[model samples]
Target: MKKLLYIDANVNRATSRTERLAQALLDRLRANEDVEVTTLVLEDEGLAPLNSARLARRTAGTAAGDFSDPVFAYAKQFAAVDEVVIAAPYWDFSFPALLKNYLELLCAQGVTFNYSDEGVPTGLVRATRAWYVTTAGGYCGDYDYGWAQVDALCRLYFGIPDVRRLSAEGLDIVTNDVDEIMADALRAIENEPL
Candidate 1:
């Protein structure tokens, strides 16, 4: 079965606009395919940021070819997925710290990516496509560092050739209709090519 990995970084799980949009998109995608979806909720995962000790453990594990360590679990899953979808609300010019921490673990060398003989990076991830869904209170314009980072990771590290983004901006603008903005974003998601 085709495996789709959904990385949820929506802090406001129950009422997050980004989560709502991502769910709508995922529902449509599911309707069109026989894919198995697996979700990773970053907020509830209790992932610790990489530190000296954790880095040492990861290094040793890689050297020993023992990826049975819990820290490498996410990376293994990430590398094996056929597709990826990340839902995260824009915050303070980026996504939440929880997602960043999760990515650190998922980007483990010898797992998600490795180096070529000439030192070029080679992605080990099996995913062919990825989607990033997000909502911004104000206009993100050119300051969308979160999506940029995700796109870079998908292309440069995950070997996902197609990375698309769906976003709703100006949600907090006093003059804009929130429902309309969200509807437009959902429509974009619906119209996206799977």
Candidate 2:
């Protein structure tokens, strides 16, 4: 079975349009019956950005090639996954800070990546593809830095070759039909490849 990790950072669960899209994606993946999905709701994790002491400990652990610490659990799980899906609402040119915090912990060296003898960083993750889902109240245009950051990280740092994004824009525009916009996004999700 393929291990798929769904990292949910959408805060407004009560009225989250992003959650609808994410659920669509999950439903599509589950249809194959060969995928095992693991959901990680970021708000529930209570993850924090690494502190000075934690950073020092991580540095030491990486240098010593020791990855037995509980702090590496997230990285290990991420590295072992066959697929990843991130759902976060667009905010201030990027996703939520909660997703960023989770990412910080998942970027552990010798876990998600390693330095080559030539001093270049090589990815260590097992995932072959990832999907990033987001919804914007207005047109993101060239300012969707959230997807850009994730795309680059998955490809350059995590070696995921087929990183893709699904976004619903202008959902809050009074002129746009929110129902139609969401229905279109759902159609796109239905056509997404496994």
Candidate 3:
């Protein structure tokens, strides 16, 4: 079965615009393929914080080999997925802290990516496409910050060329046409021109 992992990094625990968009896109994608959706709700899940020991093990080429540790298993699960979707609201010009921590777990040397001959990093995840989903309560003047980081990870580091983003800005502040803005965001997601 084709695996699609959706990582929810919002800590609201109620509802989030980015989460809704991700769900809508996932429903659409499910219509065409036999796929399994995996959700990593970072707020509820008890994920180990990537500390110096973990980082040292990862950099020292021992994290992947530490089969007894469940972190390795989680990293392996991410590496084996066919597709990935990250839903994180724009917070202080970037994604949430939980999402950052999840990414720290994914930076396994011999797993998701590796070093090339010239000491350049190369990704191993073979997803045909991936997405970065977010929403902003204000104008996207500072939006490039988060998208740029995600792009670097998904494209340059992870080798996923088809990484796309769906965003809706000024939803909370722009009350004149809030529904219209949301509808347009949904339409944009449906007609993703990536």
Candidate 4:
């Protein structure tokens, strides 16, 4: 079965619109009938932050020899997945730092990617596509730094060209048109052909 990795970074379970929308997107993707979904809520799983010890191990050439702990296991899990979906609310002009940390772990050299002559990167990730789902409080306008930047990183740095984004804005600002904001996000996910 094709593996689909869903990474949820929102900690607020009670009123997280981004999480809700992500779930909706996952449902739509799962309807394809050919994919198996594996959801990881970051808040619940408590991924370990990349510390000096981990860095030392990586630098000392221990990362390649170790697949015994959850940290290394997560990297393997990420590498084995067929697709990846990242869902996180926009915070301080970007995603949660924990998601970034998780990404740091998953984007390890010699695992997720390799470098050839002239230092050109070649990705080893089996996933042909990645969907980034997010929502922001204020309209980021032309300077949308949330998913747009993340998508680009996934494409350029990670070599995943099939990255797509679904977003909604002004959710934090209570307005009469709140329903429309949510409806648009759902439609965007529903309309995705992938």
lDDT of 1 at 90: 95
Off by over 4 Å in 4: 62-71, 146-149
- Selected candidate, larger lDDT, 2 vs 4: 2
Most accurate candidate by lDDT: 2
Deviating ranges (above 4 Å) for candidate 3: 62-68
| Candidate 2 deviant stretches above 4 angstroms | none
Instruction: Estimate TM-scores for all models.
Output: 0.97, 0.97, 0.89, 0.89
Task: Give a tens-digit lDDT track for model 4, residues 69-164.
Answer: 455656678778888999998888888887877877776666666677779877777778998888888876776566766676577666776988
Better of 2 and 3 by TM-score: 2
Scored against the true structure, residue 160 in model 4 reaches a CA lDDT of: 78
Candidate 4: pairs in clash? none
Clashing pairs in 1: none
**For residues 1-194, could you state the per-residue lDDT of candidate 2 as single tens digits?**
98999999999777899999999999998896689999999999989899998889899999999998878889999999999999999999999999999988988999998888887878999999899999999999999998898988889888899999998999989999999999999999998766
lDDT of 3: 0.79
For each candidate, the alpha-carbon lDDT, in order, equals 0.90, 0.92, 0.79, 0.78
What TM-score, to 2 decimals, does candidate 4 have?
0.89
lDDT of 3 at 40: 88
In candidate 2, how many Å is residue 167 off?
A: 0.8
